[model samples]
Target: MNRKIELLAPGGDVDAIKAAIIAGANAVYCGLETFNARNRAANLTFDDLLGVISLAHRYQCEVFLTMNVVILENEIPTLVKLLNQLVNTGIDGIIVQDLALFHLVNKHFPSLLIHASTQLTTHNEGQIGFLAKVGATRVNLSREMNLAEIKSLTRYAHDLDVLTEVFVHGALCIAFSGQCYSSSVSVGNSGNRGRCSQACRDEYDITAAGNKFPLNLKDNSAYFDLPELVDAGVDSLKIEGRIKGAQYVHTVVDSWRKQIDKFVESGKLLSDDSNLYKVFNRDFTNSFLKGNLTKDMFIDNPRDNSFKHANDKSNAISVVQIQEAQQTLSSDKDAIVSLVADKVSQLSIEKISLSLHFSGKLNEPLTITAVTKDTTVEIQSAVTLTLATDSRIDEAAIVKRFKSLKQSEFELLPFNFDGLESDLSIPFSQLTQMKNQLLFKLTKREYIGAVTLPALTHYPKLNTQPTLSLLICDEKDVDLCDVTDADIYFKLPESFKVNDNKYIDIFLRNPRLIPWFPAVLIGKDYLESVRLLETVKPKRIVSNNTGVAFIATNMGIEWIAGPFLNTTNSYALLTLQERLNCAGAFISNEINRNQIKNIARPKNFKMLYSIYHPILMMTSRQCFFQQTVGCNKPSIEDGCMLKCEKATTITNVKGISFAVDKQKGGYPSIYNHEQFLNIDAVEDLSHLFDEFFIDLTDIGSGSKAKIDKVELVSHFENVLKGITESKTSLKQLVTISTNAQYQQGL
Candidate 1:
């Protein structure tokens, strides 16, 4: 028997949600006003979400709410309150990015289903195990994954009873999701906090290749890839346009719905995708899904390409033909809008009208009845009513007690008390029991009591004076190990030769150099990394990748969570320490001073922070040189990861320049114009951290002159020693530096 594949749609507003349901969406993912990734979308309110859930469920469509942002320490209380309310709202699942949410939902609110967000960058097999251990029931695979990779990962996930979702349509990010900090460093709008300014879509100075928007990629459309995805065992096909409107949602969902039904009924696919091009797009591409990274994936323009596509497909060379194409597109869009509006008009999400009746007689049991459009619930008090002068149950008392029903998905109408005797008395406890029963019958949800987490005990620092640490990539900087006693972490690239012992020898030769793992490691590279860990057997390592951390834990080797893991709150600390047995973790730099100060560390767990480093904006598997400097090769090959060395700068129209840098064995990456230097954190947050790190790796320099690694280590050490004069000297040494992130945090 073939399993049914779910068609998930985005709902940025109430109308869009209704449109999706009417167009045959199996599930719709929507966000409330706060804590969702698409902050630009017109999100729903709490009351609106209740109605949406009720309405979607009525059509057999599940609703998943997105709380997919990193949580700050102070926001934990509010987040908990929201979770408590969500438990009784009949929400199907919650899509989350923060590890703190995983801990809270697993420990306190086990009833809420947890789905891992794409922001976690889940690509490798070990990451599936890690997410499963953290209590995720479903995981949205990274959009960059190919069909083969998705199949293998999905198989592994299924072994643990976890489902997988893939982005079948919508806009694509140039960089890996959640890993990009371009908006955060440039505008103080952290994507982790749902405030992305979309720096990737900004118009830049024309590159050598003569492209204006070098980083903008064509929108993703997998309309013809349904069979392949189903064979790959993907559970849900997710459309990625939460910031889009109802017209776009209706057109895309309607198209996919027909396609899916056709394929399922007779194993035949719909040949036409014209309805898709009638909506907003930057054209379309399936290169990423096909495992081909080429220059054609990029689009010079970032606006809607519907009219342009129509004109080009018609081969319109004359102005009249172009105008005709535009008019046709306009007409098509309006037709879709009208069609969707009519279909959704037949549906309603209004609050259900509720009526209440009270009836009783002397020496008889008191009875209360509740009526709604769909349900009728009646409950009799165990105790009989008695005639009384004081403390009688009047209309005012009944109104006050049952008015709380407004909190549910019901609007209270006038009470029907004509059947009851006036001023009859019964125990208030009986009334409370009757009200609870009415709520249970009407909502069909058990009342889950709220959970209040106890405060985390603050642990004292093990070292009174935090030591300085340095990260180095090149072998030439190995001499710095002699200059400072601080821990020198050797940087590992994202790719490596299969069964190669090059890195293993490097680690064996230098035992004092702790291995530092990068965030992304896929396929053979991940296996090679595991082989290196098994061979070298280092005492300790710093890992930005959870896949490596999972293997390290299995080997009983102590692992320190790197900065890319995005640890922000106390529950996040508990997750690392308790679940993964992580020895320590680096607090995320994306947060502000106040947010950082409130984090409580687990007992005997080390905390670290980077005080000086180049700020990475974004990283991508696609070749940056192809779009910027015009590569001779048509597409990126495996050799490019181990042999390419390129650097260039692209200035935006706003006069802000970003450096695109690619190392010999790393992915093509973009860096901020200025390096991040937070000297004030040494004095302000020194006591909370055990080590302050400095990135001595000579990456992300772009066109700037390189700084001496020895001088960097010396100055950082002096500052850690409480030398105020060295702070000024260090700032002078690194002329292009900014601490804006420390001041204006997420």
Candidate 2:
């Protein structure tokens, strides 16, 4: 049998947690005061987190802690400390998005179950497989995935032993997960770092010739469906509300509980349940889950007009009838009675007086009077009529009798028609009088199912284990060693100039930089014409970028990058090859582990174990200068400001600013000043370059401006190297840079 799907609920506060547990939820996801996606939600403190976990555990419900926000370099250390505290507190699992944090958790707490948060934009099978490989046990599938897409993903994940969870209810987002720019564009806040201001929910207008077109005002309601998603069959059903109130959570949970139970009992899913609309629903449309939604789905009109109509009372009446009856003492002489009426109104009846005349051998017209409210309505005739004493009758009979009462057209009451059951017994006369009274008091008591105790799973005391893997490499010049059974190659330029030879200086400074050389050679060179290289003799030469390679017939020069320069070629051919090599070489912004992989296919690349800091990104354009208007010194805490001509803005989160360049195809550009000086971990390249080179001419530097900035960069690079060298399992890496220099004069 397939595993039973768990119902995951949201708990913004303690009350919401209680409501979720009481309403048959199997698990609850919550956030703490810091580092959660819902930072604005009144999140739990450290004590509250521990308390919630303990309480949820007692009830046999799993509690998932959300630490799913993007962290800046300076935030990493604090986050690591918080993660350490949480691991000690015995959290069941953690939701994460940041790759560095993921690495940190895997290194420090390998046994901890990691869930890929929805903000990661994990839409396809390839992304899921990648995440699973990196120790993500479960992936919260993107909200935009349709039924067919979900099924396809589930099938693909099953083979890999990864679980797929999908959101089955709650508010829907207009943008794709992790792809939203509304927050930054509208409010200068980064949504990826948990500071969204919900700009999508705001109203907007399109205008032409001074005439405004209200794009979202047709039906006067938001159009997203929550009910249809429940039938999609996810491994876990998630309700999305961390900032919503407890009442909203309770109402939605209760409705879904009843709906799920009804579906299970009847073996059919009902779509037109009007009760669902009462539970805080918008105009329902299956957004993207069915297909690309229509323009109607974008309607953002308020439901104010519908509120007036909602207050309008319906004049329709509900009528129920008694179909059969039998005596408890006599089963053979059973009498079947039916009650009929035209309308039912809102009125209470203390006693239902039934007038019944029995036709029998008594020779006297006998009227049977029965009290329908307190005692069983029995006919008092000499010839007795048997009644059905089925336990299902008492409840049903009251409902049927009350429903058959008629009222004036203006006195209509909203009745729960489905609440009436089919099996009921009532005296023929009492059923007739019940039409006049809307409310009936029955002698029988209402029976609600007893709450069964949940079987609790005993979670063992968590034993924190070290989670980092250690790799060691020795520094050795393999090129200078024996060339036995080795294919040697060198990447060389066709011509050289001493005046303009920075690329040559960098290459000569670190000839054994395994990954950097490969990356520079693989891509098309952006700037190669200015630099020149002299002819070099080698057995085989390869060219990369726009530069050419040269090889002599006898010399053993192995070209590691760019197009191949054969030994059969002459001197002029070698010069042409060098120029061709320049076409494919360009410098990368910042080098990371992933970039290293892209560079060289080494069996085992050595990492620099001891270093001060690391740089995160490199750009041809100056990001901080663009944000600060005219490059004024701004205080570090005040953040950098970039004013754009093409309606673009940048939000600086944790020292990194995400600039949406409207002039540059709206591609997101990440800018950080500290990433340039970090030393990459390598086994045998210490002999050549003593420091990483950073060109800061674009920022128009001075001692006051460049010193502090470079110092911060150097610190991060060294710290990264130190962590690697110490072989200590690191939970996080943080880089700090202040806007103090920019704020100094202000």
Say which candidate scores most in lDDT: 1
Question: Estimated TM-score per prediction?
Answer: 0.96, 0.44
lDDT score, candidate 2, position 694: 27
Per-residue lDDT over 210-286 for candidate 1, one digit per residue giving the tens place of the 0 to 100 score: 98999999999999999899899999999999999899999999999999999999888999998899999999999
Count of clashing pairs, candidate 2: 77
lDDT of 2 at 204: 28
Off by over 4 Å in 1: 360-364, 382-403, 414-432
Q: In candidate 2, what are the lDDT values of residues 1-746, reduced to their tens digit? A: 23466778888977677667666777889998887888777877766676676567657888899887655434545776676556545567888765455556565666568888887655566456656655678889877676777777777677778777887676666545554534543344546557777653443232221112122222211113333443444567777788865655665565566666665566455464443344344445454466443433443343322222223223223321111111221121111010001011111211224322222222222232233333444332332333346532343444454432221111223332242233333354544443322122221212111122222222221212111111111123233213221122222221222344544554454443221111111101212321322321222323332122321111233333221111111111222223222111111222223322222111111111112222212111112222223223322111121223232223332232333221211111223333222233322223211222222221211111323323333343343345453222111222233222111100
Whole-model lDDT per candidate: 0.90, 0.41
